[model samples]
Target chain A: MNKYWHVVGVGIQNTLVYRVNFLFRACFALIPLMATIYLWRAIFASNADSPQIAGYSLATMTSYYLLATIVDALTAVAEDDWQIAADIKDGRISQFLLKPIDYLAYRLCLFGAGRIIYAAVAALPATLFIVVQRSHFLLPSDGLTLVLFLASTVLTALLQFLMSYTIALLAFWVLEVSTFIFILFAFEYIAGGHLFPLDILPSALANALSYTPFPYQLYFPVSIYLGRIAGDELWRGLLIQSFWVATLFGLARFAWHRGIRRYAAVGG
Target chain B: MNASSHSRAFAGWGLLRRYARLYGALWRNSVVREMGFKTNFVLWIFVEMLWFALQIAFIAVIYQHTDRIATWSKWQVVMLIGASHFIQQVFTAVFLLNCSNLSELVRTGRLDFLLLLPINTRFLVSFRQVDLGAFVNAASAVAVMIYAARQLDLEPGIVQVLAFLALCVAGVLIHYFLMFLLATICFWTVRAQGIVWGYYNLFTVARLPDGAFRPGVFKTVFTLALPMLLVSNVPVKLLVGMLESPLEIALLLGMACVCFVISEAGWRASVRQYTSAGS
Candidate 1:
């Protein structure tokens, strides 16, 4: 337990040491926000119809984007896949294997600690941006909704870590994982609601995506905060997210174990 | 004096030949390296194809909701996206990876070996790797542009196509110079990826119609200062026959030239200040 705490401490300290760089990165994240805003505003202004599209008013739609971005920053998982893949490729995993520490716990704890700092630096400015654009923004007032949103955000991180780690474990089989990472990120960008509100997607497409885990990361949480999903639907969404975390956790473990066996076979 | 000038001209031609050969060799080496990971190569192509498809889907979705994104027809926007892909891929293949790698070189002391080379360091660094996958993606983007033009009932004259191609090259140069400027900051920051990424996202707005962005001062900043908005917009507009101002072409050319000069000067200054991994 103490060792895990120490790892988390190390992560926090490292984030602090590189806080300036992280702060700059947070600022950079705003560029995409600006682009999305510009793109959507164009869509709305030239709408030539009602100010609403697919049941979304311009203000509510813009608010969705703003809140979605904040959720994205909160749930953004640092890519540890590169480090993991390198460790596998170069026999660096042996050090971790020799330790008594649980690898996932160590990785997740360290990652979570760092992101706590990252979310701090990013979320504040994002919230202020929302406040400045308050006319177009909406905030959930109910305590229950905010708690659910927070819970979902943390689970989203866990699920993302597992997803990335599972993909990284493919290094045990593949010669390289760079393409996998790129494709996964691209897929996430669309399905995860980074590009636009998932609610804006075609109803059939939205219904189909409900079965997938991608929306929970950014879409579901943002939706919850906007009170878009309410009552029983919110709890069901939470249930679905938790379901993904459990499933992904299992997949990550299986990959790690299989990867370890193959790695050992090669080492011998 | 006449004989000396002739010899100097010959030396310049010889230098060009040597660098050209060097670039060919670097590309060959890169292709060979990628061949070892054939699956990854194909995957990169597929991944890029998906991204392009999504961009199209995004455009389609918006058009379904409303017509004309700031005076851009759906087909015209598709053509613009295709031009954007071509420019971006060519930039990535030729300069993006190269300049992005600069910070790594600076950190690892490997840049010492590059600097100690007998030829120009910028030339070597700028053409270090050739991404074949990006080249394939670029060809696909050209196909998209041709298809979009056909759908729009537009048959570009040979001269217009030539002009478009030239402007595409200019756009690519602008992109390269801008990226080079960002990467050169590594000499002081030691970590310029954030700056590079920040610039990249800002640059992304260039692919969109200019009318979509905030007008007045903010737009002018991107138009002149960073010049991000002009990179793909000018060439696409020119090709689509939507460009009205001859002055816009002049502006783009001037921007490209100024960016090249500033980037080159900045790179040299950064090199001068570099303490190097040894220091």
Candidate 2:
């Protein structure tokens, strides 16, 4: 446990080294957010027939994107998957195998530390953007929603990390896994509600997406924040998210066990 | 023409021919390299195709509720998005990878080798690698454009198509110069990937309808300053017959020229600032 705490400390220092990178990334993301806000504003403006399209008023839709950005900032895997893939491909994981360390636990610590630094770095810009659009930004209506949203977001971060780690484990078999990563990312981008809220899709399509882990990765938490799912539905959604987390955890462990059997290190 | 001027013109033409042949060699080298990673190459094309399909799907979803978005019909908006994708893919095919790699070159001091080469350093650095995979996505974008044209019931003449292609070249040039300018920031910093990627994200603004932005600071900045709006909007407008004046086309061409000049100057300045990464 102390060793893992040391890993977290080291990870925090490593992440801080790229503080400038994080700052610029967080600042520049506002450009696309501006476009999305304007695009939605235009969409809502064009529809004179009703104040809501797919049950999203302009204000609520605006909040959706803002919250989505915040959620993404908190949970995005960024290049961790690629780094993991590289470690496997280049024989760096051999060190972990020989040492008394669990690679998955070590990576989870690094991810947690990275996210803590990243979300802190991004908070300023995100707050500024939200403040600038304060009229449209919505907070949770009640204390339970806030607590549940926080709980679900932690699950989301774990689920995202586990899924990415599992995919990166494919490096044990394939020479290149970037395309696979990107293909998954595209699905996650659209299905996870990064591009837009899944609720905007037809009910059948939206309902179908809810069963996928992609939605649980992002949309579920953001929706919880929006109070879109409530009472029985909220509890059921959290339960589903937990199930996916547990399932992916098992899958990740299984992949690591199998992959280690065939792993070979070339360099001393 | 005077004899000296004639000799000067001949020498310039000779330089252009040599550079063209050099570019051909670079493209060949990149093709060979890409072939070495065959699965990666094919999968990238498939990944990009999935992304482009999602863009169209998102448009379809939007149009399901509203008839028009800021004066753009469903098909017209599709055309606009397709045009943006077309420009982006072409730019990616030709120059995107090379520009993105500039930071790595600077970091490793591999740029020293390029600077020592006999050829023009900027040309060599900017056009050294092409991603043939992106051209496959470019073809998919053209397919969407054709489908959108069919839905709009428009029959564009040869001249219209040629003009659209010409403007797309201008659009690609604009993106190349903008990205090159951004990447040249690598000379001043250890790494400028974040900033370059930020500019790439900013290019998403090109896909939205120009009419969506109200005339104000946002409009002025993206139009005349960065010129994101002009990249695809002006070309698509001409193709869809929404072009109100010849001046819009003129503005786009003129902006392309301005961007080129600025990018060239910035690259030169950054090169002057470059101190090789030493042991």
Q: Among these predicted structures, which one has the highest lDDT?
A: 2
DockQ comparisons of all candidates to the true complex: 0.65, 0.80
- On DockQ, the candidate that comes out on top is 2
A50-75, model 1: which lDDT tens digit per residue?
A: 77888888777888888777766766
Candidate 1 lDDT for residue A62: 82
- Distance from true location, Cα of A2 in model 2, Å: 1.2
Per-residue lDDT of candidate 2, residues B46-115 (tens digit): 9999988888888898888888888999999999999999999999999998899999999998999999
Worst 10 residues of 1 chain B by lDDT: B197-206
Give the top-scoring candidate (TM-score).
2
lDDT measured at residue A143 in model 1 versus the true structure, 0 to 100: 88
Compared with the true structure, what per-residue lDDT tens digits does model 2 show for residues A51-117? 9998888988899999889988899898789999999988899999889999999999999999999
- Ten-residue stretch with the least lDDT total in model 1 chain A: A259-268
Itemize residue pairs with steric clashes in candidate 2: none
Q: Which interface RMSD values do the candidates have, in the order shown?
A: 1.7, 1.0
Predictions: Cα RMSD each: 2.2, 1.2
